[model samples]
Target: MGGVGHWVVIFAIGGAQAVLLALALWRRPVNRAANRVLAAWLGLVGLDLGVKAAFLAAPAPGLFRVLLFVGVFPFLYGSFFYLYVRTLTTARRLAWLDGVHLSGFAVAFAVGLPALLAAPDTNLANMQAWLAGAFPPPVPWYSPFLYAWSLSYVAAAVWRVLRFRREVRERRSDADRVSLHWVMAMAMGQVLIWGIAVVHDYVRPAGIGYFTIYGAVAVWACVLGYLGLMQATVAGDDTAEPGAPREVPPDPPAAPPAQDEDARLPEVQARLAGLMEDEAMYLAPALTIAQVARRSGYPEYLVSAAINRGFGCTFWDYINRQRIAAACRCLADASDTRTILDIAYACGFTSKSTFNSAFKRETGHTPSAWRARQAAA
Candidate 1:
C-alpha cells in the first residue's frame, strides 16, 4: 500500500507537468522564445518525474537501470532554466558557448555507458545495492564534474534574476513589471533544494534522499506552471536587440554660466515636478529615475539627487506618493464608481497589494476605509 501511494503521487505530479508543458507549447502565436524554452524545461522535468515513477513502481533491471540515465537531467534542466532567464531578460539568441554548459551531462553519460550495458543480473544487483544504501564508487572524474557544473549554473541563474531585478528597478517604477519576484523565488527554491540534496547525500546516504529531491522537483514544477501561466510576457519583450547600440539620452543642456550646485538644484527640482504634475508621467507605471532624467534633460544622478534633496524621499517613495495622491482623489470623488483594483491600475499600480500598502503608508488608511469616511462626510 505504501508503494502504491508513492507511485500514485509520482504519476499525478508527472501527468500535471505534462499537461502544462503541452498547453504552454501549443497555446498561441508562436513568437516567444522564452515560452518555448520554458516549455522545454517543463518537458524535461516531466520526463524525469515519469521515469522515476516507472522505476519505482516496478524496479526492473536492464531497461530501468538504463533509464536511470535520465537522472542526469538535473544538470540539463538547470541549463534550460539559465537559458530561459537569458531569453526573458535579454531576448538574445542562444550562443554556441552556451552548449558548453551541457558538457557535464555528456561526460557522465559517456562514463556510465559501460554500467548501463552490463548484463541484466549485474544491473539488478547494482540497483538493489544502491537502494540498500550501498552507493557504487563514484565515476573517476564525472561525479565531481557534474556537481560543480550543476552548482555553477544554478548560481548563475540566481545572479541573472538578481540582475534583472536591479535593472527593472532602475528603469521602471513598477517592480512587478515582469513578475520577476516569482522568477527570483523559483531560482532560490532550486538553490535550496540542491543544497539540501548535497548535504543529504553526504550525511544520510539513504535512498530516501532520492524521494525528497524528486518531491521538491515536483513542487517546483507546479510553482513554475502557475507563474508561467500568469505571465503574459516574460519580460517587456522590448529588449534591445543583440549587439545593437543602445539609444543614448540626448545630453542635458550645458549648465548656465556660474550656476552653482545650490542654485541649480531648484531648477532640476522644478523640471522633475513639471514632469510629474503637469504631464502625469508618474502614471506610466514603469516610470524610472533614468526615464525622468532623460525626459527632463538632466543627468540620472542629478535627477536622483534632486528627488532625494528636494522631495526628502527616495525616487520610489516620491513616485508612490504621487500615485497615492491620485488614488486619494479617485477614492474621494463620489461620482467615480470604479472598483479599487481599477482605480489602482488607472493610478499606475501594477498590483493591488502594492497599491494597498502604498496607500496605507501615505494616507494612514486603507482605500476602503478612507472611501467609507469620505462617503459619510
Candidate 2:
C-alpha cells in the first residue's frame, strides 16, 4: 500500500462508518429482513476493513495471520447481496438451504487455518519474503474461485432486479420508486472494485497502490449504505392479499385465451381509455392494474392485455404517457401557477425525480425546460 498511514486512517474511518450503518440498518423498522441481510454484510465489511487496517499498521505475523483468515471472508459478500436481493424482491424468509452458499468461505477458511498454527517466526519470514517480491508456497490459491463465486452471484442478483423491475411495471404506477436500479448500480460497482483488486493482486504494477483498491471499497461502502437504507421493500408479483391463499404452481401448459375472447378486447380497450381520459385514473399516484380492473368491471389479466395490445405499450408506459400528457397541459397553462413538484403530484407522480425522468422521456425536455420553451414560443 502506498500511503500506509493514510490508508490506515482511511480504513479506520470507513470501518467505523460501515459498522454504524450496519447498526442503523438493524434498527430500521421497515424491510426488516432485507435490512438485516444488508446489516450483516456491512458488519462483515467493517470487520474486514479493521483487519486490513491492522495489518497495514503493524505488519506483525499475528496480524498477517488474521488478515489471511479475513481474506476468505470476501466470498461471503456475494451471497449476502444475492440473499438481500432475493428477500427484497420475493418478500420471503431465507430457508436453511440458503446456507449452501457459504460453502466456499467455509472451505477456504478451513484450508487456511493451518497457517495460524505454524511457527510465528516462520510465518513472519514468509510474509516478509512475499512482501519483498519473493514467491512463496501459499500463493493465493483461492483467487480464481473467489472471483467466480462473487461474479456469478452478483450476476444472479442483477437478473433478479431486472425481473423485479418488469413485474413492478406490470402492477404499479409508482414503479420507478421501487425499481431497484440502485441494486444494479451497486452490483456493477462491486464488479469494478473486484476488477481493481484483481489487477492489484496480479499485476502489482509500480505506483498502483493497494490502498487504491480499498479506497474504492470505502467509497462503495458509503454508496451501498446510503442506497440500501433508502430502498423500499419491493412487493413482488406473487404478493398475496390479506386473506388470499398462497398460489400454487399450475400443472403443465394451458391453451391461450380463444380468439372469441380476444375479439372483445376492443371493448375492454375502450373502457380502459375512458377510465384514463374521463375518470382520470392516471392521476392516482398509487394506481394499480387491479384497481383499474375493478373500476372497469373487468378481470385484471384482461385489463392488462388490453393495455398491452391496444396501447402498444406496457402498463407502465401507458400510464406514464397519460401522466406526461396531463403534466404537459399543466405546464402550458400559465394561469395554473403550480410548482413543478405540485404538478407532478397532481398528475400522479410520487417524486420530482421520477416525474422529471418520465417528462423528459416523453417530451424530450425537462419540465422546467418544456415550460420555458412554451413560454417563449
Candidate 3:
C-alpha cells in the first residue's frame, strides 16, 4: 500500500513539473534568464524521472531512492530560488553570489558531501556508517543551524516586500500599488514553501523523512518558474525603491482599483493625450510627479497611477514620450529657426540634459543624431 501511494505521489510531482515547464515556455513577457533556468530544471527533472522509471522494472534499493531524493531536493530548491527572484525582480541584476544570502544557500547544499565519496552504499546501514565518519558525524547543531539559515533567507525576503507595501500606501497610485502587490504575492508564496521545508527538516526522521517535503517543494518551484517566464507581464511599481522586494509582507493597497474598469481606462487615455499637447510638462528641468499632477489637473496620485497602469511606464518615461512626440513634429515641419534647446524649452523641458536623456531613451538615438538622420532622409 505504501509503495502504491508513493508511486502515485511521484507521478503527481512529475506531472506538476511538466505542466509548469510547458507554461514557462509558452508564457509571453518572460524574462530570458528566468526562461533558461526553468527550461534547465525541466530537463533535469525529466532525466530524474527517466532513471527512476527505468529502475521500476528491476526495483532499486531503498537507499538509491534516498540518494535520489536528497539530490533532487537541492536542484529543485535552487530552481525555486532562482525563478522566484528572477520573476519578482525582472530587469534587476541578481548575480549568483550577489551576497551572503546565496552564499549561505550554496553552503547548505554542500551538506551531502559524504554520500558522494563513499563506495556504493547499497543500504541504509552502509550509508549511515559512511555519513557518521564523513567529516565527523553531523551533530544536532547541524540540523538546527541549517533550518534557521534557510528560514532566515525567506524571512528576509518577506521583510523587503512589506517595506515596499508601506511606500506604496503613501503614493496611492493604483498601478504602482498593483505592481508591488504582485511581486509581494510571489515573494510571500515562495517564503511559505521555504517555511514548510524548514519545519519538515526540523521534525523529520533522522535519515530521509524530510525528503517527503521534496514533493511539496515542487509546487513552489513550478510557480516560481512560471512567474519568471511571465515576468514581463508582472509589473514593478515605479514608486518602489530601485531595488525589488527582499521579503514577503503585507503590500500597500493595489493602485486605486477602478470600480468602472472600462471608464477608468478611457479617462487615463485622455490624460495621455493631454501630456502630448503641452510643452511645459515635457520641458520641466526637474519635473516631479507632484508638478506633473498639478499641470494635468488630475491628482498627482492619479497622474502617477495612470502613467504606471494605463501607459505601462514610469512618469519619467511618460514625460519623455511627450517630448519625443513634440520633437518629431518639429522635424517634420523642417523648422530651423528654433534651436533644439529652444524647441526643448518650448516643449516644457527645463534642461537640455533632461530632454536629451528622454529623447535617447525613447528614440534610441541622441537628439542631434535623430535630427541629422531625419534631415539626411
Candidate 4:
C-alpha cells in the first residue's frame, strides 16, 4: 500500500469521468435505448472503481462484505454488455426474460450476506493479512464460475457484432459508413482487461499489483466512454435500418430439370452489368443489393451470386470498383473543379477515409496522387 495514494487518485479521476459520461449518454436522444443500457454499464463500472478506491484508501472493517459486493459486478457487467449489443444490433425491446441474466448476482448476494454479519475484527484481520500477501483474500467460492459465465456473454456479444458486419455487407453498399469495428475493438479490450485481472489475481505477476490492474481499468473506462458516445445507431439511415422489412425481388421463371445455374447465370450477369453501367446504380450512396435485384428483375441471391462468381468479388467490392472507376475518370478530368471530398460524395462514398482507402487500394495511389499524375501526364 506504499503507492496506494497514487492509485486512489487515478481511480477517483476515472470514476468521476465515467460517471459524467454515463449521465450524458443516458440523456442522449439518439439511440436512446442502446445508450441507456450503455449508460448503466458505464455507471456501474464507475461505481465499481469508486468503491475500489475507497476500500484501498481506507480498509473497511467489513472487508468480506465489500469484496463480495464487488465480486458480483462481473456478472452484471457481462449481462449489460450483451444487452447493450443486442439493442444496438437488433433494436428490439428487452423482454422480462432478460432479467434472468441478473440471477447470478442475486444468488451471489444471498449466499454472501451471512458473511457480512461476521465480527468486524475477524474481517479486518483477514483484510490485513490478504493485503500483506501472507494470506488469500476472502474471495467467494463461486468466483471462478462467475468469470466463465461473464466471458460466455462477452463471447456472444462479439459473435453478434461479427454477424452484423457480415450481414450488413450483403444488404448495404455503404456498409463502411456504419462500421462496427469499434465495437470489436472494445470487446477485445474487455477481454484484455479480464486477462490482466486473472493473471494479477492468480499468478501474481511481477510488477503487476492492484495499481496496475486498476490503472488498466481506468484507461478502459475512458475508452469505453469515448466509443460509446461516438457510436451511431444502426438505424441512423432509413435505408440501413436493421429492423426494416427487406423487400424480396420477384421470383424468376422455373428452369428445366436439366438446366443448371449456368443457364441463368448469364442473364443475371447481364442484368447486373446493365444496372451498374446503364442505370449508374452504383452512384446511389445508400445503394443495396436488394435495390439492384429489384431494378434488375432478379432475386437478390442471383444478383449477389453473379457479382461474386462472375466478378470474383463481393457486392460491396463490385460496387466500389464501379465507384472507383467513376472517381478515376473524375480525377483525371482537368476541367472538373470539384474537391476530393466532393468527388468522394459524388462517387457514392459517405466517408472520406473509406473513399481514400478504396481509391488507394484499387489504384495504388491516393486520390490526390492520382490527380497529380493525371495532371502531369
Which one wins on lDDT?
Answer: 2
Q: TM-score of model 4 relative to the true fold?
A: 0.83
Least well predicted 10-residue stretch by lDDT in candidate 1: 233-242
By TM-score, the better pick of 1 and 3 is 1
- Candidate 3 lDDT at 56 equals 35
Comparing 1 with 3 on lDDT, the higher-scoring candidate is 1
| Candidate 1 wrong stretches, greater than 4 Å | 1-5, 12-16, 19-31, 119-121, 130-137, 140-148, 203-208, 238-265, 286-317, 329-343, 361-377
Native-to-model Cα distance after best TM-score fit, residue 113 in candidate 4, in Å: 4.3
Candidate 3, 155-236: lDDT as tens digits: 5655655554444333422223224444455556656655666655556445333334445544554665455454433323
1-377 per-residue lDDT for model 2 (tens digits)? 23579888889888888999999988876677777888999999888898888888878887887877777778898989999999988877778999998987887777777765678787887678645646243446767777888989999999999998898898889898888888988898999988887886789787555578777787788789888888765754433333567666445334357685588789999998899899999999878888898899877777877888777788888899999999999999888898999999999999888888889999999999999998888
Check candidate 4 and list the clashing pairs. Answer: none
| Per-residue lDDT value at 333 in model 1 | 97
Clashes by residue pair, model 1: 173-286
Give the 10-residue window scoring lowest on summed lDDT in candidate 2.
235-244
Report the number of the highest-TM-score candidate: 2
TM-score of 3: 0.46
Query: Per-residue lDDT tens digits of candidate 1, residues 178-238?
Result: 5477677768778877776777666776554656777878878877766666665545443
| Candidate lDDT (C-alpha), each | 0.74, 0.83, 0.53, 0.80
User: Please, what is the TM-score per model?
Assistant: 0.76, 0.88, 0.46, 0.83
lDDT digits (tens) for residues 181-283 of candidate 4: 7777778888887788788767986888767877888888889989887876584422334456866546665643435665777888987878788889999
